[model samples]
Target chain A: MSIDNPETMETPTGEALAEAPILTEVLPELPTVMDEQDLIIETRNLSKRYGRLQAISNLNLQVPRGAIYGFVGPNGAGKTSTMRILTTLMKPSGGEAYINGYSVVTAPREVRRSIGYMPDFFGVYEDMKVWEYLDFFAACYEIPEAQRPGLINDLLELVDLAHRRDDMVDKLSRGMKQRLCLARTLAHDPQVLILDEPASGLDPRARIEIRELLIELAKMGKTIFFSSHILADVNEICTHIGIIEAGQMVAQGPIKAMRQQLMPHRVLVITLLGRLDEAKEALLHVEGILGIVDLPPEDGKIRIKVEFTGEDLRMSEMLQALTSKGIPVVNFAEESSDLEAVFMKATKGIVS
Target chain B: METPATRTRISLNPLRPLLRNPVALKELRGRMRGPRAFVVLTCYLIVVGGFTTLLYIAGTAATYNTTGEVDGGTLGRVLFGSVVAIELFLVTFITPAFTAGSISGEHESQTYDLLRTTLLPERQLVFGKLFSALAYVFLLLLAAIPLQSIAFLFGGVDVEEIVISLLVLLATAIFLGNIGVYYSAMTHRTLRANIMTYVTILAVILVTTAGAVIALAIVEGLDPSTSSSGSEWVLLVARGIFVCLNPLTTLLSTQQYLVNQQTLFTFKYTFTDGTTTTLPSPWIAFTIFYLLLSVVVFFATTRHLKRIEG
Candidate 1:
């Protein structure tokens, strides 16, 4: 896939991610390297106040081009407000934001051209067929009449809604409507997609479908800035993640960098078939063991969480030492290297 | 329902932007498609046509005598008046309904945000909404022309009367149309917009009529023994403002003034003392006043939409 300006240059006009060839791109190509020139979305001390309530406060964000950036936080964390501000649907009370070098406040029209925004709620036009809905939005984005039909076909094909093109928009299932809404966003052939809770109310199957579609778009080199309270969705889909809490950004970078920064060591949870004191004494003096804490015992087995600052080889050696001391190591599972730790920190309001 | 008519290649004929504006095109398509538009047009024609036919039969039979003497001109004028009244009633009632929801309905459905985020300009959005919404009312008015022209066969209704009535009906639609758009922009809900549009219309009718009646009473209270140009001018100004605000008043008053005084667009009002004060005809006043009102309202709606985007 080609990476154009994705901002100042012309829109893709008609390109589907599924049909585009996937390049073997790795972490360096993804965002969180934090180069200023490649940043497609940026904010400087952006703040919004609704009457006396501060919906967003001092929000500084940086999202690079061609990155699927997940904005994760708990409910009422100002995700929607920030998305609304970036989409130019609402004005920011203070500070500034830019999309593709266009000021969100001053050059909103230009910003709008660069970004395709889908709000959390599914808002479809009543009495309109699915194709007509896409057609209407395509015309709205000022796509030429000559290219609208083919463009509509490409968009529907991309979102997997071609079969339901003739169905009434309101008559479709909720998941179908969401896919249609996502398809509508692509009608403009925008470079960046800013989705607010794209899979907020979808069933598990539908959520996975949306997640796969988003990953395909990312592979095709379109930057996606999506907000969700669900950490699991962000963890699975985002190449880069920004954790926000109470309208403030807690942490943002490539997911790997975030994991290393938050927990600069490997965490292993081991379950033992014994009483707690014997296993604890055996692993306490072992080399490469940073700390150990007893978790709730399961089925008369002792469970201990081990924080280790060591290599993969050392983890095996430490396990060997435990068994040599006549200690039973039934389960020695490595903890997932995901966003859960960072999200927990965000939720606890400790990142500030 | 799919209306593929709008799917055709857009033309470059500078006069046809409405066809290009997606909002207007979508609105026009949705309005005209399905059985709804046909049902409305059918119901309207049947009522007007049926009423005209029944009135003609009843009036002709009532005026018949042994010598077959009947004032067909009187019957014709009565038919014209009744037709105008019914059309006015139907139009005034339904014009606001079409536009009252045009903007706020988008808000209720949450599509307004999606629309504003598009590259489409705000003024174009307002224009598209207003133009398509009023298009149906205009279609209704034009369709009734045949029924209105039926009175010409009997005699007293002139081409001028028909033309003037049509103009007044159009101006009335524009007036109510703007009111609906104005309230639709100001309010967030269609029900509130509908109520406000009707309230504004009712208030204008009641206030103007009351103003006219009071001015007439003051003119009557003055001693006719004196040449009070002030009372005459007061009566004329109040009448002008009244006709300007109220379409029914403007139509009927202009017809009477034309028939009795033969004054067309503008003429002088002669004082009892050989002096004259020139004044515009009632329909002219109505046209100018409501059109200016519509322009003001158009700006108000535009400004509101701008603020919404900001």
Candidate 2:
């Protein structure tokens, strides 16, 4: 059955929360996918097309509980479309997504309850003061009037904007406005957060503050699906990364795993104390060493490429052979591939 | 000890929209806080009050030739006529401006999308705005009550008649507000909505008044006896029917209350076979029928907002 039309076709009958569906029994055989922890959001084959142009195509994403999953993509790569789909703001043309197992199409109200979405750009009613704006959204979220004051303060403190709680939103700096938006999104205490370009247009300090806030929220077990063009920021914080290009996931997995997957062969650059020419000749003669590049005469270092073929003794054997040749190794270490290198190699300059 | 259960809870708030929807309250506050609403209301009060004073002075004037006071019923009719005429003129100017920018203004300011994302249903948004605009109109009308009470100083104006007049005015304001909402929703620009709203009001007034005149003429031309019985009442009834379904006529209905003795027209009709027909109470029946039509219009506006895509 299509999700747009639920099986029973029961029109949303009332304003009260729907009754909880009874869970019969647990199936232990359903193995852990992604992480064994709770899946706050998951999508399979979600596609959104505008006319002939595919904005998002065949997208699959999983956001585990308490993880800050960064969706890194360039503009027009369908980051906003995916966020809109998950937030129940826009319907997908094909496929489906679930928020905490609630179907986005058939059960949008529930999905909305479970997620707080902050768009890239939005207007705040400038006529109202900070407290009134937060109070208004709290009401929209159906927060009880009695408990709202405390929740509002907590959120304000969380976003570090309690001092300007009385100031008009329009008077706030771009960073402060962004922080206020984040606080507003947290008013309902949603389990999952979808922030589109949260760090966009912010100065370095403000971006760092937003980054720290997301990390704190993650520590508190909130599932965060944040999209950004800032790869360095994502690398610093996000445990899982999804790189999108041309409305398709070019590469998506644990950052470490994806890096390992691409660069299985590690390169070692060694600067020697003595016997440099002999060391280069001996490294070339070593069986396990794939390639060797001698540094320029000014640099005085030899770089060797070593491919680990699931063998433990290969590196030791090469080192023993080099030592036997009387080549004293001064500094020898394998170069680690940063996220930027991994991302560049995997995407192959297709983002533009 | 409480047992842990694996389950999911879901519920929908249908009227989550209407109960605490802020649009109506916010719009009311916005309109009332504005300089335009204040200026319009103050002007209406001064005109209504000043006109009533002039009416009182005129009604007390002795005839130029006879040197005697006019009868109470004559004074009543004069006051009613003047009041209705004033209301008609004032409403024509005020109604369009109140509703012209309602929907279109939001679109222009780019606040429509912001409103939609707030989880408030579309119907609530439409009705909230419509009601808020009407509430301001209601306040404006309320401000005119003391001015209207000047008619009661003459002792001929009944309280019931005054109440009925105010009710009619209220109905007209609500009906006109809905017209503004409907057009605002349909059009994208404030300029277009304003032009269309004014054009719509003018078209309805011209068409209905012309139709009433033609219908009255046809009814009168068919019967020789009807000329003596009067055609004003029949024209009023036709106009009321038009106003009930037409927003302009709704505005005109408030004028009916401004008049002291509503002319009840009687028609002695002649069929093609040369038989005569008699009709009574056409004005009352038609006026009431039109009032009902105004309610239906409010419902129609609400329904239109429910399915609005953008």
Candidate 3:
């Protein structure tokens, strides 16, 4: 019932489209919006070079205040290096990064206080129990002794591990350990979270749980910078995605905007009940239809490439001619671009 | 509405949690929970207590024929002397076992980053561990005090001497403790740290002893009465440098106590021949040198720990 509860954040409204159009009618919050600045994280020509090897080169990123940005790249693509530089764990060899307008190098303590960074491969102190582990981190973050117990309890429950509060960290499953790690990162109540492969080695259920938790955090106006190899997860939850290849950002933008920019053309797949030679010959006379690539010899389906020049093109013209000849047009579908296709097209198939 | 009071409470230094306690209660508790610590402490007590009791009985029986009595200070000189020697022997073995595992053990367990990324500074880490090890040694020393106090039951035992001796032992243990910590910080594996620290300590002790022995021999062989005053002065200089080599300086800060009572520094030196010229007091110098060495080792370990990127 309450917005503060995570369940409320998860329940998406089907009537959201109708609700969104009403907000733009009055322009009620324009003056207030301009007062708040953008760019929680910004990098200016940030470069890291190990002798001749450049791990990350000229990385300039602007993560807005409340964006769940996915940083996707293959192994050794410098995602970890960039996270380290932003978190103040490692200094950039060339340029600098800012966290909430504070330079990471010059104001490291402020930057550290503002961001919670979780590296990909981290170990939990097995000797400590779950609560004790969180307690230690809370102490590390300099949380007041009186306030820590309540905060720790709240975080454990948030991660759905409150029942395992007294359990030894080593005994918990890998997923529980990861959730605890996230909870530990939030011990200081940091504004920004830079998670390097937060779901790197989780089971399917655990992966979904992490994804849900991240989406919940994003709704609470937190800036989450996460890197993952799972494109499906990125597609499902990320508001924006940046693809890095060989220390370079190949493509980055809102998913919808990127799809619109990259894919101006549409594909129409049609399956006819009766195959007639007249339907195949009529494909050339259509306007703005680039070319038709036929299905294999075994299948009687044909894929039509529709390039609409000025107005929306019609599949009805071909359907009308085919049906008028007593050939039924059984299946007509539009092929939409998903994140996988966008990633493939953007990277140009060169992962390294 | 109530009016607010105009009082402000300010904390002068807010980062005090990072200072954390140096006593290493966590380390002591862990060590106490294990059987190894108890066994070590037990063995140390038995050896030191048994040795003092045996010496007290022997010295009392041997002096029975004399009318003059053997007093507590004389008994303590013999008993505490052996206790210090055996402690040094145990320390050589035990200090390495505890400290050689510090950094390298963390590296082995892969929990190093857990501590390193925290607000705790590296010097605090080094000294925290060093003081913890020293506390264990101090506990063992306290256990021997009752046995040592047995000598006070007799006459002539000086409490100030006993106190000074314990202080010297604590300082020396701290110095050697840092040596093991420095080695542990330098290596990635505990086994290598253990081996290297043992070898290095052994080498330094042996080389210094050998050099001291040679200098003493040369001084003894020369006849100071027939030699020139310059040769006599050279002998004094050699003997003075020899004081630096003796680990016994660790026990007795004063120069006179470090040099053997039997060995003579030839008295035929200046115009005032036969008037003994005392060597300069080495307490201040040795304390400064060893403390400086400990500081350097702590700084080096901190530097090494700070450079760990991952």
Candidate 4:
């Protein structure tokens, strides 16, 4: 956890240095006040245009440090464009983007040093072995040659590709390749990771593995800002979610807060074994119940759907009230809110 | 658990990192790893060697009986000239093949974005590609040294001749390599870049030579007298400027200087008032012109890359 030594010169011959422990002294520590900062990646009125077509318009994003900010958008929704600007790979035509307090346009090298970018479609050097590929990138990042061997081994372990260290990159499976790419992004140990559709072409299992790996990276104090069209993957892993559509951000906030804001009412389903009439009468007496719809019985149990306007504690109290009155409540559950539903409510499917 | 072979392969070679160019190292390693590199190298040597042997046989046969003695110096000059000319031609084609795809290949493979996002600057990327391609071309030129050495034994070609020939060849490779890198940065498709690079090289070689020839013909017609005139001097100076930019002219000029101890185009020009002067050697002018032109093209390529990525 020491600062990078500017005086640590690399020998002209690219000789390897003495072996050291993998992670402890290798990577520079995260900035002390990074967590206290309001945003690790921020953009104000960011815009891009290709002649007449606007790729991204008025994009204002604030991604807090140490959070997995999922950028959710449909295809061609300017998600990739926004990520490109933030990664310093492209210029924003109208506005500005800052990474770790450095302007992407004004101080691009600093921005590059602060962020690891994984584009949506990237090519690996098929001729290179996994370890050699990592070593090459580490060299590009100016990591001391002596430090690369241990760093490569550590990254391979992190992405679960330790067994494929010497395997040709082209020989890896799609999932393994995706994981290897993720590992490559971590080679320089940047504080922020900007991944564009990291799981786009992955199978379900591969997607899950990438998701888990991203969660682990976030746990390691890295700010993960990734873009995806897959709402399920985003929902499962992202602590904060931003939904963009048609080159504009529709909504962005914490997942729970977003769900609550988009969906104000909850649907409660109650099942009764024998006291069907008793449960119906008792449910109508609850104060927060707006309406109740009786459903056809299945498996000899009565079902009722109640439109309830209450928080978790009030819902629990209502559940307790039913069981106290000899209603024989077999099951009482509230329907869970999902990202797909939230996305559907948030965007009008417009694209410019 | 390190094997001796692995240890040797991974050993720190100080010269390896001196350039501090990861792109060049990656490219050189990849270029040398495949059997194709060996195949190309072998073919190049065989062709150059086969051609030199044929020239020697022809020259020896032509002059063997007429004088009852073989003139080794004349025979050496013929062999040296032919071999150097062939190397120049081979390099013109070979350099573009190595460089035309350097940048565009990354784009084609979808790796350009990944590379651009790194801390590597655009200049390094451009120069890394140029150096790697030139390095391979230099290797090809190096392989022909033994064939050129045969000229020395024959006694007609001196070390200066061989050195000047290699310098011209190297300069030509560098100039052509810069063209390839330029087009590679301008275009995203490898095929397109390759075609454009070759076209530019052809245009340079053909147009410059043809233009100089036509201009010299007109200038020669202006004054048929053997005596040097002011107008003829002006034309000679103009022709020197034109021919120096062409690699063929530059190579021939260097040979003229080395073999005859004379400039490529020497014309005594008298001013209207009778003061006279001789034009500088085209070889010196060519060397300076090409080196400066290469720098300009390199900066252009670097600027194009920066603009495109932005």
- Candidates' interface RMSDs, in order? 2.6, 8.4, 7.9, 2.8
Question: Per-residue lDDT for B112-181 in model 1, tens only?
Answer: 8888888888777888888897889888888998888888888878898888898888888888988898
For candidate 3, give the DockQ. 0.18
Off by over 4 Å in 2: A1-37, A267-279, A282-289, A293-335, A348-351, B1-19, B28-119, B154-156, B183-196, B223-240, B246-310
RMSD per model, one decimal: 6.9, 11.9, 8.4, 9.1
Enumerate the chain B TM-scores of all models.
0.90, 0.72, 0.78, 0.88
Off by over 4 Å in 4: A1-37, A271-281, A293-304, A311-331, B1-14, B17-19, B219-228, B261-276, B308-310
Residue B244, model 2, lDDT: 48
Model 1's TM-score against the true structure: 0.89
Give the top-scoring candidate (DockQ). Answer: 1
Residue pairs of candidate 2 with colliding backbone atoms: A15-B12, A15-B13, A15-B14, A17-B11, A18-B10, A18-B11, B80-B258, B80-B259, B243-B249
Q: Single out the weakest 10-residue window by summed lDDT for candidate 4 chain A.
A: A2-11
Candidate 4 C-alpha lDDT tens digits along A131-180: 88888888788887677888988999999999998889989998898898
lDDT of 3 by residue, A1-352 (tens): 2212222233266354344343223211111111114878888888889888888889887677788788988888889899988877777988879998899888776887788777788777545678767776776666755676788889999999999987878899988988998998888888888999998777555666787788777766678899988676677677777888778788887667777677666666666655635666665566667667665433645444434332334666655655676766667666666677777788855554
lDDT of 3 by residue, B48-68 (tens): 877777887887766443557
Count of backbone collisions within predicted model 3: 3
Q: Which candidate number maximizes TM-score?
A: 1
Instruction: Assign candidate 3 its CAPRI class.
Output: incorrect
Candidate 2 lDDT score at position B260: 28
The DockQ values of the predictions, listed in order, are 0.52, 0.19, 0.18, 0.49
Q: Rank the candidates by lDDT, best first.
A: 4, 1, 3, 2
Q: Write the per-residue lDDT of candidate 4 for residues B1-310, one digit (tens) a residue.
A: 6532355467687756545687887777778876988999999999999999899899987756466898888888889888988898899999999999999999999999888888888888998899888988999999898898898888967776677677778888888899899998888888999999998888888888987898678675664545467566667667777788887787676666556654344534445445777656665677668778889999999988887344
